[model samples]
Target: MKDTAKHQGLRNQLVSLLEQKGITDKNVLEAIKKIPRHLFLNSSFEDYAYQDKAFPIGAGQTISQPYTVAFQSQLLEVKKEHKILEIGTGSGYQTAVLCAMGAKVYTVERQIELFKKTSVLFRKLGIRPKYFASGDGYKGLELHAPYDSILVTAGAPIIPKPLMAQLKIGGRLVIPLGEDVQIMTLLIRKNETQFEKHEFGEFRFVPLLEDKN
Candidate 1:
């Protein structure tokens, strides 16, 4: 529960590394700095929690690598109070970053084990999302649809159509698209029937699962 001076120093180093890697969004960087990343990891991993790498959480899901979280977050262009839909909650590290930016986040997790663990984590950290669900993220959180932005944390074979339908006009969806390897794809909603697409380089992520838990 304690974020000591050593942890802060390591976080500073991580932020510096990210800046050198071309992450220019200050808000995303600051959120990464402020969040106690170690708190989201297992006791065995606490020592290297700020090293910008992914570590297994539980239920076969990995807390997203720090650089990946920052990259997708910057692409999402979070605005204060902007409604955000996060497809995978994992250890809730990324959700905490969104909360730090004052975004109203609706996060869904497919693994029930992770959902329960991370729900308790939110209480301990005093972070809250607008909604949290332990269900298939492929369906998206339809009850709270039309988000200003949607962020998919896992690698998908193709963009989920439900997620596209839930994005508000002029909003963006940041997702990694592929099977064994992924290309970071950003889709911007232009109108009801049109979207602008862009692809960045490759990334590796746990596959986004459907109904199977």
Candidate 2:
């Protein structure tokens, strides 16, 4: 009962934060609510898990801010049956939210240590995504090609070609693109050979590396 109450309170707080920031997608909001954010963090930072700020999770990488996670997820426009690909698996929080929303997620993480920890957390949460790989996220996941939606959690100087090739027609990819300064851009695969692009807003994230682990 205490655990249920804690989750409920976290949900309320998260919904309030999203609503305040104009995250109007009800499905996205519910997914973010249902996932236990506290479980993704170290116990020392669990109390602040619901806040709209990033927290360090060792290895110098931080779990993304909640609003950023919700905002990127809202852009994906995920449905119950969409096959989603996430390019980074930091702490697996966003992956948890994606699975909670009923999407079959295929995620990749470049950092082996982080990937291992995050994968264990996913198992502990009992949320089994379709695929989890510790490799080059810049290449995206090809085994599950032509994804309904793609999300890149790390910042890149430019859109990665392999990632572009993995998008299905009518599918959309939300990514943070730029070098030192970054803009969160959404790329929609309009057809077999054309892509429509739009910028969501300015944002900052760790650089998307090309090395495969």
Candidate 3:
């Protein structure tokens, strides 16, 4: 994918907008500035990539809005080499952002088509997550348990218990919880059984799909 100076300029503008909108995490903003968001979408929609909007990526999924990505990333308080489990790989844009910040990300995608497509894109962009699995988001990857942070990119009706259980004590889980319009919820693991909950404003996202088979 060709990332021209114009595209970089657009990303700079987007980062400024994110900052004005209260995304103060410098690393998060830097990742936003560095990643070529346009390369994550189909070439035909390249013009719309840098805007703070979601666009269809196929298999009934949309890449998350830039602000949403930044908000979730900032909430996670990602540290370099932190282990992160991401639900809903989608367009792989979120995965790339986590990777950019030096987190070892293990991402799950329920839609095989999107999973495969995004895997190819990650390779092309030279963005490598720690692991990629085509599986259920609700069933967080237990093989690599106790992540420092977990992020769910889709709208969930409830906090997936498996995801909550997988977090290390003091770990953060960022999810959009609802069926129609999601309330951005942050759950920080307080102990083996208790979690501290906080809510941000409302956001719209594609439903988190469960495997039928």
Candidate 4:
């Protein structure tokens, strides 16, 4: 009973926060509220879960802030049956959001420890994604090719070609680009020959490195 009440309070606060930040998608807001962000953190930091800041989860990685996760998820423009590819699983908060939105998520985490940790947490949270891979190969999840949307949480100097190839025609890719600082970018496939690109704004994220563990 106490646990349910805590979750409800957190949900309400998160919904209010999302609204203040202009996250208009009701589905997205509901997903954010439904997923328990505290489950992704260590017990000591669980109390801070409702706060809207990135918190460290070891391995030099941080669970992305609620706004960033919501912002990225919104940019993906996921459909009810969209097959989504996530480049960095991190703490799996973003993946949870995508799954909650009714998308089939294929997520890859480069760190084995974080990957395994998040996998167990996902089971506990009951936010099952379509695929979860732990290891170095994060170019893209090609086995399940032609995803409707691809979201890269890590900021990369250049978008990985494999990820671009995995997108079906008319699919969308949202990633953060540049070094030192980053800008969130949205790319839409306009047939095989070209892509339409849009820059969202300045953002800060951990550099997306090729960690082949």
Q: What is the C-alpha lDDT of each candidate?
A: 0.95, 0.88, 0.94, 0.86
Candidate 2 lDDT by residue in tens digits, 1-213: 024687778779878978999999999888887887888888898778888889888777789998999999999999997999999888998988898899999999888889888878777778898999888988888888989999999899889899889999999999999887689999999888899999977987878888843
lDDT of 3 by residue, 48-114 (tens): 9988999999999999999999999999999999999999999999999999999999999999899
Candidate 1 vs candidate 4, TM-score winner = 1
Instruction: Candidate 1: count the clashes.
Output: 0
> In model 2, which regions exceed 4 Å deviation?
1-4
Q: What is the lDDT of residue 22 in candidate 3?
A: 97
Query: Candidate 4: where is the Cα deviation over 4 Å?
Result: none
Residue 202, model 1: lDDT of: 99
Candidate 1: residue pairs that collide: none
- Score candidate 4 by TM-score against the native: 0.94
Q: Pick by lDDT: which candidate is best?
A: 1
> How far off is residue 160 in model 2, in Å?
0.3
Give the C-alpha lDDT of model 1: 0.95
Model 4, 1-213: lDDT tens digits are: 024677769878978988998999888998988877887887888778888889889889988889999999999888898999899899998999898899999988888889888888888777789999974434687889998989988888998898889998999999999997899999999998689999999888887868644
Decreasing lDDT order of the candidates: 1, 3, 2, 4
Give all candidate RMSDs, comma-separated.
0.9, 1.7, 0.7, 1.7
Residue 11 of candidate 1: its Cα lDDT? 94
